[model samples]
Target chain A: MSWLHIFFALILLPAVAVGMIRILKGPTAADRMMTAQLFGTCGVAILLLLGAGMANPVLIDIALVFALLSALSTLTFVRRTWQPGKKKHDDPLS
Target chain B: MTILYHSGTFFIGIGLLFFLSGTVGLIRFPDIYTRLHALTKADNIGLGFVVCGLSLQSGNWAVIVKLLLIWLLVLIASSASCHLIASSGMEKKIKPWTRP
Candidate 1:
């Protein structure tokens, strides 16, 4: 019974692989970072599924932490990449 | 009942299909914005079905509450992250992909 969910967990691997490829070939830096975000969400889903399948509640807690941290990663990305006040006349990198 | 178990499995199967399509769209979509749309929308719904399926299997209040929390948290995070990514792209002035 639980093994079936584990099989489902295994099925999730290819999505992560695809996300990795996007990280590699994504045209823009934001694209790469967004792909990583996708990985984080998928990782959460996989963790939840596996925790239930294996009867290990700890994986669920880890998924909770993973979700919180993934959001942090996005915040870091936006902070580093976006410059709201710097207009066209100003240095774009700043 | 075996029928309930089968129904739960069926729900999970549907969820898996949605997840597959979402990931496929994440890669195949023409641009980053659209790709984000694909992933966030489809994957969120997919995870919903999966949680529903799992809840049916467990029949426990605490576990079900935890599953709901996980879903809600991811829901909030994905949308927030999506906004951040969109704003960053706009900040950098990345052009959207215009359909031919």
Candidate 2:
């Protein structure tokens, strides 16, 4: 069972790394933001798996909090990028 | 009892395979929107399978309930976040891949 937990952790690490690459190399700001959200989701899954494997119940709470924070961060990023009172035609329409 | 354990392992293996495919799709996809779709749908389902496997292993009512709740929360958040991000990208004119 512990080995299975380790397997999950191993898989999750590479997933996070790939997401980080997108965050770092994304062509646009929105792309990076989306990658960050993906990373957050992966983190929650990994945390929960670890908690179960290690027999520590407290980590479940941590995973829940991380999930909430990730959602809030995504909302904040969207709100920041799409601010109101800005002219839609600031640049010539593509 | 042995059958139950073997079934649990089989589900866990399948879940891992799906997760690996999701990762590969994320890397191979040409555009951010496509990658989001792969991860949000495929990976979310893969994680759901894993949670189910874990619940079976736990064999306790309280822990299984907690696992189910966690999976539900993750599913909802993953889809919502993907939608929010993709729509925001469209608004910004982030432009998808040109290749068909």
Candidate 3:
């Protein structure tokens, strides 16, 4: 039912919020980045469920965009912000 | 008709379980590699289940196809990013956590 879709969508919010702890305490940049990746996937799922529950087709398109943008964000982080064997703050171009 | 609805709910429930377990793993795992293993695998499976469930509930074929496409994109992106993160961690000389 529509309520089921909404329920699923709401439950996932806490999961994503809990994931943020990794970003706070993550020992390394990669660890933090992992949480971001998790966000991307979770976000897509949430949007999908919400779209179904609300009967709004446009939300699905937004979810698709969310998927692509999250991936792009991770790629940029890995290539530009993360420098292996060195502190990220030390990078000049980052 | 009712059976299809119930089954769809069942799949979504399973997907939620996977998502929870994956989050637990992300929190409890000892190392980056292990966390990545937990996350990339579990979450993708979870998303797949969710997609499957939503598609079952949906009457339109186009929505179903769109859902599947989103799942595939997330799958590919998550795995690739997982690999990139793991490799970069290795390059950084971060040692894996062994039982201590």
Candidate 4:
């Protein structure tokens, strides 16, 4: 059982690294947002696996909340990015 | 005697292969859209398999239910988020790659 937990953790770590790369190197804001969502999902999975491995029930609730928040954040970002708007230039002299 | 252990190991191996392929796809894909496609599809399936293997080991009905719920939530969230991101990227006119 412990070995399975370790195996899962090992599998998840590479995903985390790949997600970080996308977040860092993504060509567009939307791309970065997608990468962030990936990280959020992976994070929740890791927490759930850890909880199950350690027999800690409370972590499941925490993971659930994290999943909900991640979904909400992605939705908000998508809405903002998709809305029609003129590009805002931040120039004090304008 | 050893058949059950072998079966569990086979399931775990398949799950690990999925995860590895997903990571490789993420690293090697040319564009954000393609990468998202790979990650959303492969990771969710990989995690699903892993959860199934873990639940088999657990042998607890309550914990199995919880695992299933978590897997469902993950799949839903990942697919929805990926769709939203890809559409938003298209709306923003992010240049898609073209092989010459």
Which one wins on TM-score? 3
Q: Give me the displacement of residue B30 in model 4, in angstroms.
A: 1.2
Clashes of 1: 0
Can you write out model 1's per-residue Cα lDDT over A2-46, one digit (the tens) per residue?
898899989888877877777888888777887777777788878
Q: Among all windows of ten consecutive residues in candidate 3 chain B, which has the lowest summed lDDT?
A: B83-92
Which candidate would rank higher by TM-score, 2 or 3?
3
Kindly report the root-mean-square deviation of model 1 from the true structure over all alpha carbons.
Answer: 4.1
TM-score of each: 0.89, 0.84, 0.92, 0.80
Error of 4 at B27 (Å): 2.4
How does model 2 do on interface RMSD, in angstroms? Answer: 3.9
How should the candidates be ordered by lDDT, best one leading?
3, 1, 2, 4
Candidate 1: Cα lDDT at B25: 87
What TM-score does structure 4 among the candidates reach? 0.80
lDDT of 3: 0.88
TM-score of 2: 0.84
Writing each residue's lDDT as its tens digit, candidate 3 over B1-100 gives 6787789889988998899889989999999999999999999999999999888888699999899999999998888788777777887788989998
Tell me which residue pairs clash in candidate 1: none
**Given the true complex, what DockQ would model 3 score?**
0.54
lDDT of each: 0.80, 0.74, 0.88, 0.72
Interface RMSD of each: 3.1, 3.9, 2.7, 5.4
The recovered share of true contacts, given per candidate in order, is 0.56, 0.31, 0.76, 0.39
Question: Which sequence of candidate numbers ranks them by DockQ, best first?
Answer: 3, 1, 2, 4
- Worst lDDT 10-window in candidate 2 chain A: A85-94
Query: Which has the higher DockQ value, candidate number 1 or candidate number 2?
Result: 1
> How far is B96's C-alpha from truth in model 4 (Å)?
3.2
